[model samples]
Every structure is written in structure tokens, then in C-alpha cells.
Target: MCRFLEELGVAHHSAGAWHWTSDTYPADAISLRAVTSDNFVVVDITNEEKVIAEVAFPAALLELHEKAIYLHEARQYQVEKMDYPQRKAFVRQVECDYFTDAIDYTQVKILEEFETCPLGAARAAHGEVRVNRQIVGFKKVKFYTNENVGAGALSLPEQEMHTTSFWLHFPDPFLARFSDLTPTEKLNSISGMGNALRTVAALLLMCDPRDFGVSLTEEIRPGLEGFEPNLHLYDSYPGGIGLSAPLYELRPRLLAGALDLIRGCPCEEGCPSCVGPAGETGARAKDGATRILAALVEAGLESGAAPQK
Candidate 1:
């Protein structure tokens, strides 16, 4: 490790220990957490050009976008301008009764597949993927009632990321069982299943929910058709942080746990603890997700694909 650091011109080996080579403090140059290292600065332009807070890169698209409501220390600020080139957001204090939730469109393409297994009619795999995401708009929801009072459109540049992911591809034979479901319903089902997987993965990994991200897509790659839709759980960091491989290994346990979580939930439709909030995930999301997970579990059991430690 010291040799690698020395090669990077950051450290030197002397007296059986590694020492900083530069006059500047090494700690000052290094960020403790890789995910939060590249961040955007928020400036308050109401009174003066005062630095208010900092937002991480992944979150800046949703939290610091133009017209977005940013909450800090229990106070609310409205983002008036977002200068992506400058890596800064100009916001002003505002008294509003609602908050904002950004709506984004994401596409994931497999860059390289590391490991794969056939679980019944579905294929589970872990690999590197390139994610293309664009924040299209946001909804203004009232504070207490959680009512979406309004929404606005946004035109911003797309953000691309390379990360490691654990994904499930439902083959056409498996999806045939859902022939009665419309395309929207299928999409909703995938969304719900993805949410459940994210929750269960976090629990199994003993990590925070924010450490992983979920995405459901009909097209795993561009122009691909007749293939199964994909539900992905990716490490939410640049270059990843050793999460996807473990998740791939625990695929069976993850699916079974997700099934248990959804089946045991008390909500009739769906809640945050299960699939997702009913308002966003559709009315039949929980039911569809339950059925999908049950099928996955059943297939794994029939094939005797036990989780490998």
C-alpha cells in the first residue's frame, strides 16, 4: 500500500513507516468517503454570496436543481440557479408549504458480466454497468398531506456513471405468465420488485439504504427486444465499493428475504416499508412484486440453488 501511495506521489517510506511527501497535510487532501468527495457548493444569494452548504454529486441533480426546494438545518431554500459548469447552486430562503421530489429517467447498460447463474427462467448476474440518467422534472408535494400540488419540467444535461451492479433478467418464458398485465403494470411490478430488492440487499449487507441504488428497465441495452426486463441494485458510488459481488453471491437469500418482506407487510397496496409509497408505485405494485418474488424463490428452490457463503 505504501509503495502504491509513493508511486502516486502522495507518500514516502522512511524509518519503517509511511510519511507524507508534501508540506500540505495529507488528511486535508484526502476525502474520508469517496462518494462525497466530489460535491457541489450551495450559495445563498438572498443577502450576500454566502456559502450555505455542500451537496454530493449524485444528490446535486435532485437536491440542487433549479426550482428545487433544498432543506438545511430545518430551514427551506429555493434553488434559483444551478450552474453545473461552476459546480455551484444559488439559492434563497423561501417560505413554502411543500417540498420537491425529482423525477429522473435512467438507462443501464452492462459493460462486463462477472458472474451469472440461471435461477429457473430468470438469470442473475453481477457486472459493471454504465448508467445514463437525466433529471426531467420534479413534483411539489405538500408537507403534511404529501399531496402533489404541482410539477415543473427541467432541461438539464444527463449524468453518466460507471458502477458495479447485481441484476436479474426475467426471460421471456417467465414474463409470459404476466401476459394479462399491461406494459405499465409490468413496469410497475419491476419497480416494486427493485425497491424490495434494494431494501433486502441493504439489510443483508448491513449497510445504509443510500449505499445502493435501484433501477428497473425494459431495455437492458439499446434496441434490445424480446429479452426479459432487468431489475438492478447497484452500488451508489463511482467505481463501486465492494458491494455487488457479495450481493450476487447472496442472490437466493436476497430474493427470499424480499419475498418475506413484501408478504409480511400489512399494507393492502404498498407502503414505504415494502414496495414503495402507493402514490408513486401504483395500486397493484405490491401484488405484482409479491408474485414475481414468489416465482423467483420457487424456481430457485426447485433448482436447489442455495445461497453460497
Candidate 2:
């Protein structure tokens, strides 16, 4: 930082500290959220159009997309149109049996690692990560039954953020245990394990599930041993909400809770309560996730690590 300022001729070195030589207040340039001050305004177009709510840039890509059902004060409002350039969403009140849930694809790149350790064969770590997400579609889920009633495609620009995340990665030795399963099934298991972990993590952290986002990727190598699949639980907000660091410390409890939840679920294969809806994930997602979690726990015990404290 000091070198950058000096290179720009705005700061000078004196008394072993950098002194600002420019007239600007650098604090004003710093922002807590990794975004501009612009926000998308939701306008109620039912009777006479009136401003209803405001959504941040990153969230607007998913929430303010055309055909999305926007909920405000327990009232359902279906988005009719979105003016991308103007950052406004036109919505009208409607009675509907379901709400919209956006489906997005996320990619995480590790920016910096804060801590890392082995939990049996798998490794656990927490760090700053760059998250890029694109909302490709949405699902309309029925209110009472929680069923996926319908879906529609979306075309929106991707959103990116730098946030803190807690991740668990599996190496080649761990992957060897699941060699009997097909490639797709292994990927599905990774996805299912991520889903279960996100739920249990929220419970352990005493925060709403929405506070964090989950993703599965084979791009990161925190262990530096090789490329491996890593399941990440990240803070949803830009920058961070200071959640991942504590979650890293509670790794053992999080894994245990997720395993217990999956094991105790009454559904024979899988359900939203455990791994995921049966067919959506693989047929054996429950078994796969259970095996992975149990192995992780048992490996920890055998090596005297047993996850983390």
C-alpha cells in the first residue's frame, strides 16, 4: 500500500511510516460492500406505480429478473419487466401458489488461505475467495408441498464478489474409495454433501441459511498436493459477514451434525431434508454422502484429528 501511494506521488516515507501528500481522504474511497452505490428499485405497478423495495446489484441479477416472484411484506408480486440500464424492476401484485427460486452456477477461486488442516483423509480450510455467479434459470416451488412446479430460463450478466469461505477438500486417496461409483454419481455425491453441509453449518453458526452460499468445485488445491474436489460454504455478502472464520473452527461439529441429519432422515434414499430430492441428485446420494462424512469422521479418529475442535 505504501509503495503504491509513493509510486503515484501521493505519499511520502517519513519516520518509517507513509505520510499522505495528497489532499484526498482515502477513507472515503474505501467501501465495505464490493459494489457501487447503485441499487435496483422495485416498483409496484398494480394500481398506480409506486416504489416498493430496493435490491443490491448482486442480488438483483437473481431476484429482479423478469418472471421472478418478488415477495414483499408477505405479499406476492410477480416481476413483469426489468429495465437493465435503468436498474428498475416493474412488478404487480398477484395471487400465486408458489414462489420463485433462482438457480445459479457459482465458481470460487481462493484469494488467500487463513487456516488449513487435515481432518482424516480430507482437508479443511478457510480463506478469502473470489465468487463469480450467473443466474441461468429459476424454479417455481409450490408453497405447501415444496414441489418444483415450473421453471424458466434467464439471461443476465454474471456477478462477482470477494468473500470469506470455509471449504473441505478431498484428495486422490479419498477419491479412490469411491472409484466403484460412476463419474456422474461421484459429482452428485459431492453436490449432495455440500447441500447437507450448508444446512448444518448454518445451524452450528446460529445464522440463517441465506447468510451463506454453497458450491462444489474441482479447481482448487488448498493442500497443494493435487487438483481435487472442494466443497465450499461461503459468506453470501460481498467482502464477508465474518462467518467463515468461526465455521472453520467448528469443523468437527458441522460434519457430525450433517452426517447425523442425513442418517436420521426417514426417507430411504434422499430428500430435501437430508441430501436433496432423490432423482435430482444421484439415486445413492444419501449413501454416498453418508459414506463420505463417516469416513471423514472415522479417519479423523484413526489419525487422532477427528475433524477439528
Candidate 3:
């Protein structure tokens, strides 16, 4: 695999080595190893769509899959299989199963055969879903494998949470877009989502409120006194709502519930389904939310709660 990657012009470094020696070698082992090490791009040669689904490859490398563009790929899946209502539904179910099962198998090394399906399924399901030079948010993704939702797991453990323990700072351009909303309104919406998520995380994980403070604002200010958690909210970069579970933590039902909610969302560009409000966020912020949402849904958190919008 290393040879193949190098031949394909992929770099060979500390992160370049593949862990093919494992029992699950070729499929999950390869992709898991690459993703875990935070490799920005992977030159995958497997003819399996299932593996592709598992890794959430960056949009930059999708040309290797064929010639489909990201936007077109998103739409092609709608009718890739006869456009039959039931088949479409089945495709989603199977996709959710494939992705979650991949996550489960990779993290725990428990179930093997079931998670080894080819990515051809994903390709067949979405004929033109190309992941090209669009800067796919592959790097911002993170994962945990557990059997319990709370016994030993977090409701939503986002990548940003793992990478940084900081607050959000709206870019001047993005902040300017909301000029009509008064600083307070902008602050409310921004911090409101964070507060809601922290509150929910504390409630779900049974962790002490002090550990994950309730505040969302940079500092306490006048008029926003009611949002007490605002004072306690720590700013996190690449932040957004998402779920984290150990290899043993996930159950089939919990995974299914998460997918159902994701497939049901109305937004085509992020939003609650794929991420948060895309048009309303900065360029960097837009990708993180959508990628996190997609990762959670793929990981089996379709119903992962988002703060009330």
C-alpha cells in the first residue's frame, strides 16, 4: 500500500506508513491508520466504496475516484438506484449501516466480515458523487469507539474539542454580515448554540456542570446576564455539536436514530443535517460544521441533538 501511495505521488512520512499488518489490514486498517494520523490526503486504491465512505476523504483527492464533482455527487445519490422511494430509503439505511459498521469494526476490531463491503456500494448508490478540489474537511474529523452512550461516551465529542480548548472568534467579514443584528443579537445566536450544546452534553454525559461550564461569551457583559452559562463557555476552535462513542458504546438502534434525523434535515448545504448554518458562517466555519455533522451522521448520530435554533 505504501508503494502504491508513493507511485500515486502520495507523500511517504511518519504519517504515510499504512498498518496493513493488522488482521483487518486492507480495508478499515488502512483507512483508519491514515485518518488517525491526520493525513490530509489519502491516495486510496481500493475498489471499495465502503472504505471511501469510512474515511470521508478530503475533497481535494476525489478526482482519483473518477470525474464527479462534489455538488453533483450530492444530487446523484437521490436517483442513483431507480429513484424508487423504497430503494432510496434502503440506500440510506445501507449507507448508514456501512459507515457505522466500518467505524465500529475499525475502533473495536470486533465484527469483521460485515464491515468489509466494497465502496462500490457507495459508488453505485451515488453515481457521480465526486469529491474533488473542494477542500473537504477531512482533517477536522475525530472519533471515539465505545459501547455506551454515557457509561463511557460523550453525546457529541467534536474534533475541534480534541484539537483546541478555545472560544469562537467571528472573522471581520462574517461579523460584518450580521451588522444588522446588533452585537448582542450576534452574540446571543453564537453563544446560544454553544450554551445549549454544553448544557445538553452535561445532562447527557452526567458530568458536572462546572467541568463543561455553561457560559458562551468571551466575558460577562451587560444585558446578557440571563445567559449565565455564557460566562463559563470556553471558546473552542473548529467547534460545533457532534457525538463521540467508543467502539463498544454504539448500539444499532442508537446509530439508526442518528441517521434518520440526518436524512430528514432540509438543508442541502450544512444546516442541521450536514452541519450548521453554511451561508451564515465564515468560510472556515462553514466547512467544519458540515463536516462534523456528516461525520457524526456517518458515525451513527443522525439524531445527535443540536441546540434549539
Candidate 4:
């Protein structure tokens, strides 16, 4: 930055420091929020085809995608078609006992690790990352039962953001007990763990749930030191708002709280209240997430270290 400014004749170096000489304010030409003003028009095509609501572009993928169960005024409507090019969603009235949640695949590349430490059976780290994700599908979960009744595929644009995250991965030596589970099962367990952790983290931080995003590590390669499936709780904003560090500091309480929440939930398998809906997460999600958190808390206790907070 110093060299670039020097070449532009707007800055000079003296006393081992770069000094700006420009009389004009540089921030005058900058915009803080570059977010687009575009939004999706939700059209109710049941009778007269009236417009019901307008959803922002950022949230349209998850809420207005095709087959999504949209709720308005305590009434249910099924999205019949989503015209992406036109930014419109066509919906019809429907009486159903289920709601829909979008499914997406995400990959996080650690650009720099701000900090790292042993946290029970796993290692926890907070760092800057590049996240790429897309809305690949949606699942229909029963309203009260929380049973996944159906799902559908979607082809949507991939979104990427640079932010900070708190992540946990188990060491190869520590994964021996999970040998009974398959690779897919292991990843699912991590997904369930991400769900519980994100909820607890949001409550602890007193932030809106949408302020945080949850995802799993890209690959589950065996024999790699700590390259097993892992969970990440990341800031949804382009540059983080200082959430990851606090989460890292409160790791012990975070894990213990998640464990207790899942353990105390009355759901037989898994529900939105804990872990995740069983059908979308697989029937063993609750058990898997509980086992993982319990192990982490136990290991932390054995190490004679209390939560850093």
C-alpha cells in the first residue's frame, strides 16, 4: 500500500512511516454497503395471483426456492416455481403438516489461523476463511413431528464470502472410537454438531441467528493428522464482526451447553430443537452429536482445564 501510494504521488515515507499528502478525503468516494437492492417478488397464484411479499436477494435462495414451504400470516403455501431470471416465486395455497428448509454445500479454506489450542478430544481454532456455498436442495420436515417427508433439488448460483470462523477437528489418533461409523455417518455427525453449536453460540453472543453460518470441513481424509470431518461456526458478514474470537475463548461452555441442550431435548431421534431434523440429518444425528460433545467435555475435564472465559 505504501509503495502504491508513493508511485501515485499521494503519499511519502519519512521517519519510517508512510504519510498521506492528499488534501482530499479518500472515504468520500467509498460506499460502506455494496449490497444489491434486488429482491424476489412472491406471487400468490392460488386465486387472483396477487403479490404477497418481497424477499431480499440474499435470503431468496433459502426461503423462496422451488418447493419451499412458505408461511405467511400463519398460513402455508407451497412454492410451485421459482423464476430466477425474473426474480419471482410462484406459490399456491396448501394445507400441509410440514415446513421446508434449504440444504447447501459449503467449503471453507483457512487463509490464516488467528489462534489454535487443544479443546478436549479435538483442537479448536479461529481464523480468516473463504467460504463458497450454493443452495443445492430443500427438505420438507413435518411441523410437529419434525420428520423429513420430502425433498427436491435446485440449481442456484454459488455465493462466496471472506470472513472469520471458529472450527474444531479431531486428531487421527482420537478418532479410533468412531471406526464403527461410515465416512458419510461421520460427516453427518459433524453436521449435526454444527447445528447444535451454532444455536448455542448465537444465544451466548446475543446475536441474530442469521448473523452466523454453519458448515463442515470440505473433506474427510483418513491418515491425515487432523483432517477428519469438522464443524465451523462462521460470521455471515464479509469481514467478521469480532464473533469468532469470543467463541474460541468460550469454547468449553459452548460445547457443554450444546451437549446439554441436545441431551435434554425430548425428541426421540432428532428435532429442530436439538441437533437437527432426523430425516434430513439421518436417524442417528442426535446420538452422534451427543456422543461427540460428551467426549469433548469429558476430555476437557480430564485435562484439568476450565473454560478460558
Which candidate leads in lDDT? Answer: 1
Per-residue accuracy of model 4 over 1-309 as CA lDDT, tens digit each: 889989998899999998989888877655444344678999999999899998877788899898898888888999999999999999999998889999898898788888877765577888998999999998888878667789888889998889999988766665667787766777777788888888899999998777788988754444655456557889987888889999988888899999999999999888887888787688777887888788888876787544332
Q: Once all C-alphas are superposed, what RMSD does model 4 give against the true structure?
A: 6.9
User: Please, what are the lDDT tens digits per residue for candidate 3 over residues 1-309?
Assistant: 676764655434356454333343345445432233322222222233221232232222322122211122342221112111121111111111111111100001111111111111110000001111121211111125222221111111112222112222233343454345555555545533443344444445454433432223232345643222211222111221122221112322322343344345575533533224444333333233333223433533333322111
What TM-score does candidate 3 get on C-alpha atoms?
0.20
Native-referenced Cα lDDT, model 3: 0.28
Off by over 4 Å in 2: 1-38, 56-58, 73-75, 95-98, 142-149, 220-227, 306-309
Models 1 onward score TM values of 0.91, 0.79, 0.20, 0.73
Ranking by TM-score: 1, 2, 4, 3
List residue ranges in candidate 1 displaced over 4 A: 6-22, 33-36, 220-227, 306-309
Better of 2 and 3 by TM-score: 2
**lDDT comparison, 1 vs 4, better candidate:** 1
- Off by more than 4 A, model 4: 1-37, 44-50, 74-81, 92-99, 141-149, 219-227, 266-268, 301-309
Write the number of the candidate with greater lDDT, choosing between 2 and 4.
2
- lDDT for each of the candidates? 0.87, 0.86, 0.28, 0.83
Model 2: how far residue 199 lies from native, Å: 2.1
Candidate 1 at residue 112, lDDT?
91
Clashing residue pairs for model 2: 300-306
* lDDT measured at residue 237 in model 3 versus the true structure, 0 to 100: 16
